[model samples]
Target: MISIQRSQHSPIGLQLGPSSATLVQLAGSRQNRVVHAIAQEQFELDEKQSIEERDANIAAQIRQILSDHHFKGRHVISCLGSQELFIQNVRLPQLPVDEIAKVVAWEAEERLPYPLAEAELRHLPAGQVRQESNTKQEVILLACHTGILKRHLDLLEQAGLTAVAIDVEPSATLRCFHNSSNDVQTNATNCYLNFGDAATTVIFADQQNVLFLKYIMQGSNHLDHAVAENLDLPLKEAIRLRKIVTNSPTLDASDELHRSVIDSIRSILETISTEVENCLRYYKVTFRGKKLDQLIVTGNESSPWLIEFLSDRLSTECKMGNPFESLKCWPTSTSILERPGRWTTAMGLAMKEKSNS
Candidate 1:
């Protein structure tokens, strides 16, 4: 656990995930940075565990990760992933900055699934949109259950960490590749596809800021389960075999087992591809954004085959997203570089400066 070293130091990034806890600490200034991130499987809880038991188990897991890594800084910026969030892209008539929140609350009345009173709501400006001759401001309305947020904070408290801010995973992901489209900012846009465990996040942005965001409920886990069912293997074994097939660029088509695994996951692959198409089409038609220059892929389960499938479907170039740019790293942190994409959210959280928000 890295200790906060006055104002000049970056706060640690602590991502409290359902199955894993990722912690990252960034050292140095904006241009020159060094980062070390660790992702540890947290304690698995059964339904029988009481709330107190669950908290203690989870807190211990968080502490174990910190102790094993010896990362300093208890002050951290954390995030709420898709499962705990409800987000919508809505268009609103222009209004004074002071009155925007009120309008968002009103607009959310017809959109949010839950009563507005029971939710913690926040709105972010997603730039302007024009339809026919009318112009409206596009906003991303975000909501999380009040109790869910309380539990999040409670976990942080139990783990002896200070929450400088709470961020949504999409925001953290956007922060990781904000500058990805800068080179082609004037003519083309960049798409970020963060293939998470339970959901795949889609963000359309260019150079400086995020223009749109959406989530697909189906994620890499679906594919794993599909393979598991087909091979009659346990999930752990299925995941290992699937990863081996995906990581191997020269996977043998003649290998009967590998071929069967690929065949099993075809449906989920098609579903993800369709979702990507819908997101891209919506962004183009609504935002009137430029052509997509490239797709920036991330997440632990992302594969070379998935990238190829997407790239071919959209007729756009694709590549793995890289957030590490001028950062010095310790010799022992090679794993961070090896699977950097999986730690993108934590890295982005580490980059976020301290704020009450």
Candidate 2:
């Protein structure tokens, strides 16, 4: 139900997340590319402001960001978090391409949480499934509440911008990895883990298409909160200490504070590992012969310790994902690389133009 209009100019990419909004503008062809600007603004909720007023304020902030960056055009492709959308994989009998949509709508009526009349549904044909006597097709179904979509559209309209298409975070994250410089093994299955402030999304895929997706409510913020509570430190200080411990080679056993920090971080890592293991187990059961080849972690929460911990626990090769690896940018774009993981969704949204072309 998302409409995408291809334009001559580069389309702006926006990711409105629970904690912040990230916007990226890219121009020129891929070979002569220039990453015009990448900006992120954290939201400060005011209890006194009504929902409308708060949205208007955020729109005002977005306008200022675009104006200061000298970005052109008001059209953008945005991404919604998995928490805001309903995604499911459905299997249906083989049918003509034209009939697929109609069948999917009927199926969605029963499966979607929202009323079919009040939801905008979209379907992507994943692939075909072969049975002993017949063939069926697998489809990825995405449904969003009409109110949620309208709210986003209204916010962008108030910001003097138009949203051309809205994408899910998991798909956008997959786009980042697919377009990265890393060599993807065609025959091997891979899992992409997007760790966000509110949730973590695990996407099972290969070089071509997504095989499965699972959302875990636990995220990097949970780890930060745990560290803060365990260490009896302020949130900011706990965040700093987490980074220090994660990046350090080893904790000082003689220091009680160091030992405590280590223990807290390990506990959170163990939780994350367990969740990932469960997903992997399901994947294995569903796709008997297939094996997960590697794991790619991305998002603002990804760190050295997280990767190392998951690698050891999952017994799989794990690495951090870099969204900027394939793009050429101006000198000012260096700042975008600092938190490359945070920009994956936005960067992937920006790549829609090229991908479609």
Candidate 3:
């Protein structure tokens, strides 16, 4: 199981995705808090490096970055994408936190695809579920394997950075919204779609109720490849062009290469629509009373046009997710906080500290 003696407060948050790594540091005080965000320099593993070598290098680079920034000895919370872990909404007889382990083990036999011993297990009590016909009450259980976690922690330890909390990226993303949105819409059905490097995570929750979750294997890399193929350029050059186009309207959005990129985006939209609809359908069947109210998009791979396209296709009102947008910050930190949507996971990891307080 993922070991935790007691949760330690971490001011620095590291969100490592397949494509890029984001670092967020808490700056200033309680009265005038701000975030020092860095997204430009990311650790990219060499394809030629072995798994052990790559993990070591990732840790080393992270440490070097911290040293260079003069951010030594700061507690750091590392995060993992949903694709790397397994999560199931298991229904079990309601019991105290300490007693849930045996139940988790019993459920793991049926729920987990691998051997029970091969994975580490963890669970959170998601309230009680009382059945009308029977007197027995059940609670939601969340389980995660240890093997998946060690891979991430091993890398961090190798890097010379102290890992405080390891978080699920989707949970972290949703936590960002939960912290930002007031109780006015507390019970409303909300969905957060995080477009990470290797995959996309869709989280649908209603206040304390988590209804749907899915990770799709689609991502922005397809667009990169499409641009490269059509432009007859290397992948790196294509990525450069893609960013240039996004930042400036100088290039023709209708050019042959750009059209290919657009097509790739459309494909992503199709999958998102299908997956979201499936979730909505399941939610409707299970939770007949609640209705979905909003959809938010985040992650470095997300694009405004993608949201617009999906909104039109799904006929659901969509908005950019900027968890830090409404939060108070210092004047000098305004520029860094401009793109708040991209920092959802990091902000959420940092918010864990706030929750403990």
Please name the candidate that would achieve the greatest lDDT relative to the true structure: 2
Query: Model 1 off-target regions past 4 Å?
Result: 1-9, 40-52, 179-188, 326-334, 355-357
Candidate 1 to truth, TM? 0.88
lDDT of 3 at 62: 75
Full-model lDDT, candidate 2: 0.77
> 38-97 in candidate 2: lDDT tens per residue?
787766666599889989988888898889878779889887776678888888898899
For residue 199, model 3's alpha carbon misses the true position, in angstroms, by 1.6
lDDT of 3 by residue, 162-247 (tens): 77787777667766666443332666888777876677777777753556666777665666776778668888888877765544
Clashing pairs in 2: none
Question: Cα lDDT for residue 114, model 3?
Answer: 81
Q: Clashing residue pairs, candidate 1? A: 1-71, 1-72, 2-71, 2-72, 2-73, 3-72, 3-73
Query: TM-score of predicted model 2?
Result: 0.84
Q: Per-residue alpha-carbon lDDT of model 1 for 250-353, expressed as tens digits?
A: 55789987798889987887888788889988888887746678888887655566677777887778777755642454325655565457777887888886
Report the Cα lDDT for residue 84, model 1.
Answer: 89
Q: After best superposition, candidate 1 residue 160: deviation in angstroms?
A: 2.2
Model 3 stretches astray by more than 4 angstroms:
1-10, 29-31, 68-72, 92-101, 124-144, 181-184, 229-232, 245-257, 330-339, 354-357
Ranking by lDDT: 2, 1, 3
What lDDT does the true structure give each of the candidates? 0.76, 0.77, 0.65
